[model samples]
Target: MSIAISTALQSSFADAVTRTREALAGQGFGVLTEIDMKATLKAKLDQDMENYLILGACNPPLAHRAVDIDRQIGLLLPCNVVVRTDPDDDTRVLVEAMNPQLLVQVTGDPALQEVADEVTAKLRAAIQALGPTSG
Candidate 1:
């Protein structure tokens, strides 16, 4: 199965990040943490790159359900959503999220399928709400 669900937005990187957060929030997911990859790389290694950010998003109810089924699931909790400019085309911004189904697939646990399915749907909706996407 595909590992990520993503969309391309015709907006500046900063605008895309804001819209991505709003879209995820509309789907009942909240940003629990954020990492500014561009700044980190520049500061630590004096490297330069396109704007990039990772938002740790979580739906508390869904997260709680998954953890109840498998304590180790926290390792994958707060699904990561990345907002970055396309390296090949700086004019385009990409918003991508981890496919929630991976949790069930990796664990090989049928019980977690239900929660994964729910999260997958919500994540899909969040990506769709952003704008047009390509497979």
Candidate 2:
């Protein structure tokens, strides 16, 4: 299975990020953390890269369910969603959500499968709500 659910956005990178945040919030997900990869790389390695941001998103209810199924699941809590400017075309942005099904596999628990499916659906909806690509 694909590791991520991704979509191309017609909007600018900033707008895509905002839209992603809003979409995720609509699905009961809150961004718990954000990492600006470009800035971090530039600061630490003196290497410039395309605009890229990673949003650590979590849906409390689903997270609680997963943890209830397996306490160790906290290691996978807060799914990651990445928004970045396409390297070949700065006008376009790409957004991808970490696939939650991996959690079921990692936990080796069939009980968590339902939780993973639900989370995956929510994440896919958020990405779809971003609309179509620029070109």
Candidate 3:
């Protein structure tokens, strides 16, 4: 089962980044953190690397309920979305979510899986929307 869904865009990195932000915001998530992997590597390791940005997005109400059911589940909240170049030399943006089903195993809370699946769908939709600027 694929936990992530991705689409390659013909547009430049900046355009894709802008669309990614908009798509996520439309789905009730706000970017809590943005890590520029390329810039971080160059600054710390002195290596020029391809552009990679990590968007840590979160939806508040769902998270509050999920954590109330199981405190340790916070480790998985605010799912990760990665936008970067793949190894094949093709620039691709990837959004990976914590599998909704897996939450049931870890915490034994089926209610949380429902919430996770909803976010997963939105994340996939956002990735799809970034694919050509068309709808």
List TM-scores for all candidates, in order: 0.97, 0.94, 0.81
Candidate 2 local lDDT, residue 122:
94
TM-score leaderboard ranking = 1, 2, 3
lDDT values for all models: 0.93, 0.90, 0.71
- Candidate 2: count the clashes: 0
> Which lDDT tens digits does candidate 2 get at residues 67-87?
998999998878999999999
Task: Please state the error at residue 49 of candidate 3 in Å.
Answer: 1.8
Task: State each candidate's clash count.
Answer: 0, 0, 0
TM-score of predicted structure 1: 0.97
User: Which has the higher TM-score value, candidate number 1 or candidate number 3?
Assistant: 1
- Candidate 1 collision pairs: none
TM-score: which candidate is best?
1
What would you estimate as the lDDT of candidate 3?
0.71
Order of models, best lDDT first: 1, 2, 3
- Give the poorly placed runs of model 2, Cα more than 4 Å off: 132-135
lDDT (10s digit) by residue, model 1, range 1-135: 889999998898889988998999999999999999999999999999999999999999999999999999999888999999999999999999999999999999999999999999999999999998654
